[model samples]
Target: MATAQAAAGRTFTTDIPARLDRLPWSRWHWSIVIGLGTVWILDGLEVTVVGNIASRLSEPGSGLPISSGQVTGTAAALYVAGACVGALFWGRLTDRHGRKKLFMITLAVYLAATALTAVSFSAWWFFLFRFLTGFGIGGEYAAINSAIDELIPSSYRGRVDLVINGSFWIGAVGGSLLSIVALNTDLLPENVGWRLTFALGVVLGLVILLVRRSVPESPRWLLIRGRDREAEEIVASIEQKIEAEKGEPLPEPAGELVIRQRESTSFAEIAHTVFSAYRRRAVLGFSLFVGQAFLYNAITFGFGTILIKFYDIPAGDTGYYFAVIAAGNFVGPLLLGKLFDTVGRRVMISSTYLLSGVLLFGTAWLFSRGSLSAVTLTACWCVVLFFASAGASSAYLTVSEIFPMETRAMSIAFFYALGTAVGGISGPLVFADLTGSGVVGDTVLAFQIGAGLMCAAGLVAAFLAVKAERRSLEDIATPLSVEKAPTAEAVTE
Candidate 1:
């Protein structure tokens, strides 16, 4: 049974936050990870495959009559723009409805759009589908991140979130390998192979949908939405399963958070909460997100173009090099994820950002001098992104954790939209122009710009970062609905 005490103006207290934070890690947590986390993998796969096949889309007989620059620049920017819009649209819905509802809906949107993309006969058709695909993915970022943080125990939240976000690189590895096969003329036709690549994502999304159906809505969200009975029932069910697995009684939960339940939140309250109460966090979040978005968008969307134009590398071989780079990205989060939980968020986040930025600067210098081969250049990228990937993943983790539960999804959406607008869209456009110019110096200058932004963001993180490790979400930022108790006579009708 939930414990609640009446305070002023219908304010009531409950221990839902403490109860969730005290749960043990088990197969249940693994199920949540598999069900929700794999969205990032699908996103990575989609982006990488598109980047790898930019050249194929420009081929005369490939059904699309667009140039390589159009494919990478205009198409990529449209996708990010769609993502920005989708993040805000779906993010508001996620907060108003519920996490489970929006995540499943967004995933469905992605699957349908991606399957349709496989049948595109023109550049406009492809661009429309790509925008829809990004729209779905953008929604996933807000919904999934909020759900994962709210459900996972505080002790495990950092590493779990990082690993899940980093799983995008695992999809990258798969995409890279798949592209090598699909792009091979001897194995399959150019147009058919690229279409098949998108079809594969649909299959993966279907499987994830099945798993997602079994995951429950967040108990914390339910309680705050005035569904305390439902929240209590869900938590009781979870504790039963967990205790059954351990063959021991769970410890009693401590601490209670008092809040006046509200049916819905308004945009004005969200703006005031972010801008007035948590302005510093907003800055930190934007800095980290913009830095990573610029660096990643510049590299992922442009790497294939760089290889083909710069080093005279065959288009088919770009996937092989990309696979090597993807491996490094995956390894960074897998290896360094624990330290974010153990050593704490501020130090680890800043260090990863700074180190990756410094490494990228060195890489830019080497590339400018024409001192690197395709192979050697890829090795340099692997090193730079090993740290950058982890840092990038942490950006999502930070935004999700630092905001109030009521505004968690929207806060993530706002930052992602702003950062991607400024960085993600422009990175591809700038890099595509540089690649089209066929000047190593121009591309090197682009790399330095990405590196400098990363370093500056790292400095901001060092000073403004939230020390949120192993702390309950309520402790990190008290809910807006929380208020001090008044005498019974003072209670409003």
Candidate 2:
């Protein structure tokens, strides 16, 4: 998302042609974000489905040993590893083979693997399926993001992108809801409840696929590949729609779309494009990836588990607490999600980290004392989740915006994968390591550490990042060229 972004933004005047309504979602551009946003939701769901059902997985006679907790956690790690690898393959593939085709591939891999995971009989089988599913997920960092970045208008990009990005929480809720009902039932064996949790992932994926199918090929990719005819066809459709809305001829396409050094770019060539060219992006992008993975992964994967086990919530009603926790998850991103756009990315990020850390510290105090009312505890926790999601959600879209088109996909694939390898892979282990030997081991202290990390990262990022009013996605991407960048990519929806 970071490396290959363009130095451009789409210009949309209120002069929206009346024909705008006639264009299908796919043709409009922002639809790409919507499409990928849905993918992010489903993939995120697959990643956590097993964790949400860890209680059931740990049940006796479920064919797993008492070590099922670690077993599933390890599987989550491996899934992230697969995503790291998959991103390497798919990011470039999208650039080379075109975003549309590779988008299809990632979607299918995730959708199919999710369904298969639902039926696995052994830990190894489950592990293998998750690992494979991670590959498709890896591509998502680039494919949907790149498609969306290239499609949407810049002014609306941050907010719209963040909102679409909010689907991850929506998926998180979906996973929790399924686990809540299915984990409590015998519609499948207790062992099979986890499977049903994963199998249920297919429904969202299918929806993503259907919506994505309506979205058209990337005009940017088409033009770059020298498929000018197809590119023009898409452009013509866009122009025709714009003209119709105006009841007149559309204004000339203003920005110059250049296809430089037309050779097929190898992985090394693609990588060199960033590390060799832009060091500022290298540091910023890596930070975004690592920070997000470290903080967000811990919160999502550990939140429900810790809420039930360490907090002493009864198992029968664990789902209810988990739901409360998930609601906290949704509540965070839903209301404050747009902070990235209105408040400026740096302010929002810094505020998110600082406030969330304070919330965590407060939570730590509450857990240590063990004297807080239930309502107080839940309210405080939910506040933390709100900032957490708002800040964290911005990371994904922000990462996508920071780099140029040439290295956008590659940079995103590299750092997100790197972050996943570092933070995403390590987060659960860190939680598992907490031991909670202290009074608030799993409950308050653990979350404090997580929130503190976000605060720290945000502080560093804020000081280093461009000020909010001055921030624009295109400005940071593609520094090698002396020529001025056009604008940030357009939003389609």
Model 2, C-alpha of 384: deviation from truth (Å) = 1.1
* Deviating ranges (above 4 Å) for candidate 1: 1-10, 484-493
Model 2, 254-321: lDDT tens digits are: 33423332324566855676666555556656666666676666555655555555567654455555
lDDT of 1 by residue, 1-493 (tens): 3333322135577787788899999889999999999988988898898888888888987777778788789889988988999999999999999999999999999999999999999889988998998899999999999999999999999999999999999999999989888888789887789899999999999999999999999988887777787888888888999999999999998777777877788999999888778999999999999999999886568888888888888998899999999999999999999999999999999999999999999999999888999999999999999999999999999999988888999999999999998899888887778766788888888889899999999999999999889988877877767663221111110
Query: All candidates' TM-scores?
Result: 0.96, 0.84
Candidate 1 residue pairs in clash (backbone atoms < 3 Å)? none
TM-score of candidate 2 against the unseen true structure: 0.84
Candidate 1 similarity to native, TM-score = 0.96
Off by over 4 Å in 2: 1-34, 61-66, 186-188, 242-254, 257-261, 266-269, 372-375, 435-445, 467-476, 479-493
Weakest 10 consecutive residues, lDDT, candidate 2?
Answer: 10-19
